[model samples]
Target chain A: AQSVAQPEDQVNVAEGNPLTVKCTYSVSGNPYLFWYVQYPNRGLQFLLKYITGDNLVKGSYGFEAEFNKSQTSFHLKKPSALVSDSALYFCAVGAFGNEKLTFGTGTRLTIIP
Target chain B: NAGVTQTPKFRILKIGQSMTLQCTQDMNHNYMYWYRQDPGMGLKLIYYSVGAGITDKGEVPNGYNVSRSTTEDFPLRLELAAPSQTSVYFCASSYSLGGSGNTIYFGEGSWLTVV
Candidate 1:
């Protein structure tokens, strides 16, 4: 079974400081990884995805993630955190051709202003 | 563009009551999915449809039913609503299967509370 684990339940960072949310996955084949952000009372919004090629993938709102094959991790990062960037982040994994996605428990990001 | 739309933004249902959550997409997406989000927990797939007339169960499909009658409509039905069914339901669609170039668009979500 393909699954994703987000180690932290919450991450606190100061505004303008760099932030990282760790994610790890276990899958049988090549993994299709994705990052999604959800604001209060709203559905998730797609941030970025890693399917093949580049290990470092850039996403919306100045977000990026590095896919490490050796460690089975795809951690989301932002050079500078903003108060508006605080939200719930989810890490998901799916098989190369599968349509189903397995998501992590989610990490609540809080940007302290 | 009204990417994906779900009807009845909020509803309160009594135990044993039944209702349907309607979803539609105008993007001509071939794949549609229904998911429910509980407090703190991430979204769990209730059901999914590959295309019109084809549907399958997902991780948490025990209390829900889904139907895909047209390419643009996928409605989820909750039979004998239980307190455990209280959660926000989301409808999503995708043009391609999972992976690159297959980004899923989500609806605003239908918040349901079963007492």
Candidate 2:
């Protein structure tokens, strides 16, 4: 079974400061991790994904995440936060061959100016 | 591309009434999915179809049913509208990795309320 855990329910960061949203996962084989962002009343938008290769992946909206295999973690990061960055972030994990993806609860990020 | 498109943007149903949320994709994806979003709970998969006529249950599939008659269409039906069924529903489509692409595309979503 594939499972993802986002320990933090909410994250707040000052504008222009770096922000990080933690995510961890457990899966059978090589994990396919993903990050998504949802604005108010909108569907989730894909942020980035780590299927194979580099541990660090860059995504849209100046967002990036690092995949730490030994720690079983994939944490989202932004060099600088903007007010428009405030939204709900989700972490998901899927296996190499499996089509099903297991998502974490979520983390609400607030960029305080 | 239009990616994934869903209909019935907002709807209110009476108890015991039934409704179907329609979804379509133009990306020629083989996999389609239905999911419901709840506050603080993220998104829960209601049902999914690997291809036409191959629907299967997902994490939360109790009160809903789905059908995929064509490669582009996947619809979800709610048998009995209950207050618990009120939620924001999303439809998504994707392809298997190593093909054209691996990213899953999602629709704007449909908001349903049962009164």
Candidate 3:
């Protein structure tokens, strides 16, 4: 079975400051990790994914996430935050041959301007 | 481009009533899924289909049913409406290449309220 955990339910970051949203996962084999953002009354939009090759992967909207194998963690990061960055963030994990992807409870990110 | 589309953007149902949420994908994905989202609960898989004629239950599939008649269409059915079933439903589809190359695409979502 594969699962993902996001410890923080909410995160607040000041505008123009760096931000991070933590995520961790458990899987039998190598994992495919992903980050998604959802705005009010909208569907989730894919941010980035870490499949293999690189421990650090950059994604859309200047967002990036680091995959730590030993720690079993993948944390989303941004160099600087903006007011428009406020939204609900979700972390998901899936292994090769697994059709279903397990998602975390979600973290609500609020950028204070 | 209309990657994934879902019908009945919003719906209201009374107890005992039933409804079907329609989903279609233009990408011709072989895998389709239905998920329900509740406040603070993230997304719970209701049902999924690997391809036409093949369906399986997911984490939360008790009150719902699904069918995949074609590669592009997968519809979810609610047997009996209940307050517990009220939620925002999402339809998604994906095709795998290998080495975890699958990236699922989601529909706009349908909001259902059981009164």
The best candidate by lDDT is 1
Scoring only chain A, what TM-score does candidate 1 earn? Answer: 0.98
Worst ten-residue run, lDDT, model 3 chain A?
A94-103
Off by over 4 Å in 2: B97-101
- After superposition, the stretches of candidate 1 with alpha carbons farther than 4 Å from their true spots are B99-101
Task: Give the per-residue lDDT of model 1 (tens digit) for A60-102.
Answer: 9999999999999999999999999999999999886687888
Q: Backbone clashes per model, in order?
A: 0, 0, 0
| lDDT (Cα atoms) of all candidates against the true structure | 0.93, 0.90, 0.92
* Candidate 2 lDDT (Cα, 0 to 1): 0.90
Q: What is the per-residue lDDT of model 1 for residues B4-109, given as tens digits with 9 covering 90 to 100?
A: 9999999999999999999999999999999999877888999999999999999899989998989999999999999999999999999988433378899999
Model 3, B14-76: lDDT tens digits are: 999999999999997888999999998999999988899999999999989999989999999
Better of 2 and 3 by DockQ: 3
Using DockQ as the yardstick, the better of models 1 and 3 is: 1
Q: Interface root mean square deviation of every model, in Å?
A: 1.9, 3.6, 2.5
Over A1-113, each residue of candidate 3 has an lDDT whose tens digit, in order, gives 78899999999999999999999999998999999899988888889999999899999999999999999999999999999999999999998878788889999999999
Two-chain complex of model 3, DockQ on C-alpha atoms against the true structure = 0.53
